[model samples]
Target: MMEKHVQEFAFMKCLPALTLAAAMATVGTMIPVASQADTSPHSGPAQATASTQYPVPTFEGEWAIMAMDPVKVAGNRALGPAARLLVTLPDSLQKIVGQNHFSLSRQSGSAWQGKQDDLTVTFKLVSENSAELHISGKENHKLDLPLYRNN
Candidate 1:
């Protein structure tokens, strides 16, 4: 019984300190990290980095992967050459590429290229409506997909 009383006394004395520490932690989280980070101007080239702009291709936009079986589209012989080419792409090229996003840094008429994360992304406009999306990633993994202009 006496040990219990001593234990309670110790806890009572520590409670205020624990509450203060918890309150400090709460206040720390309430403050935005951006407001706390040092924003003062540095003495060197780091400031110039803010102005370095990445070139954006004029055709930078999302494209979709076209799932086509040449045998299915075979019946539609009347399809235009460009449309036909998109549909008849070899199975060797068919791929399930996630996120049909394109941000080509460089462009030349129908061709475009850009680096997205670790993947090299490229596209070729087949028509005003259709495009080809190609992404090459680490270990030479490549993806070829058909796309339709989303906008």
Candidate 2:
């Protein structure tokens, strides 16, 4: 009975320390949530997921293929025959690329391949700002185009 009393006394002595430790832990967890709330515009269910990160790098803006008028386009000849190709990834579709773009070809590593209606679209990222786009249209028309980010 005497030993039991001593043990209870020890626990009583440590109670305040244990309560402080639990409070500190709760505050530590809340700090990150508070900071994340301030930094991120979308929280809770709207937060971005792993799938949102899969869109081709530098492929989120407006891009136009080379034009015949070299002076207007600043003579970006790497465009080659793809001069007629125009690619646009509006902000709306960029967020759900997997459900939209990946439906056709699915995402190959570092690239996206898919078919929309009669056009077969393949996008390969060469760099952050440059990518190779291949489109095969109906009637055997094929365009192997290099794309550059415009915006």
Candidate 3:
């Protein structure tokens, strides 16, 4: 009787191992062949497609000036100040803004340029939401202002 009981216990233990092995085999065979297809050749265009997720900036509404620092001239004179700008991205435009549409070019490093009528402004980022704005080339002459996002 003891021998029969020992055999039954061994069989029960083996049942769990058999079940586990069968489960693994089932899962291994279930893998979709399409998922394992060579994706490397298609990866470059896929990455390029992902980059297009961001949209470009356009002239639509009000964007604020964040910061402004003078860009030193060759002879210690101040040709202009660096500036940064921010625009409260409208719900309609948020998707495009994610691609860095509000960003502009400046005469110096990391500085952005803005224009209003006859005025052209230069700016640099002090933070993600703030910038230093330098306004010139108009009757306003020169102005430094802090621009902030609405939300």
> lDDT score of model 2?
0.51
Model 1, TM vs. native? 0.34
Best by TM-score: 2
For candidate 3, report its TM-score.
0.28
| Superposed model 1: Cα runs more than 4 Å off | 1-102
- Candidate 2, residues 18-123, lDDT tens digits: the string is 9999999998888765334344555323322324433432344544457521101111223323222223443343342322232323354345566767767676
What are the per-residue Cα lDDT tens digits for candidate 3 across 7-70? Answer: 9999999999999999999998998655564567644222112122211121212344234222
Ranking by TM-score: 2, 1, 3
| CA lDDT of each prediction against the hidden true structure | 0.51, 0.51, 0.44
TM-score of each: 0.34, 0.37, 0.28
Quote the positional error of residue 94 for candidate 1 in Å.
Answer: 17
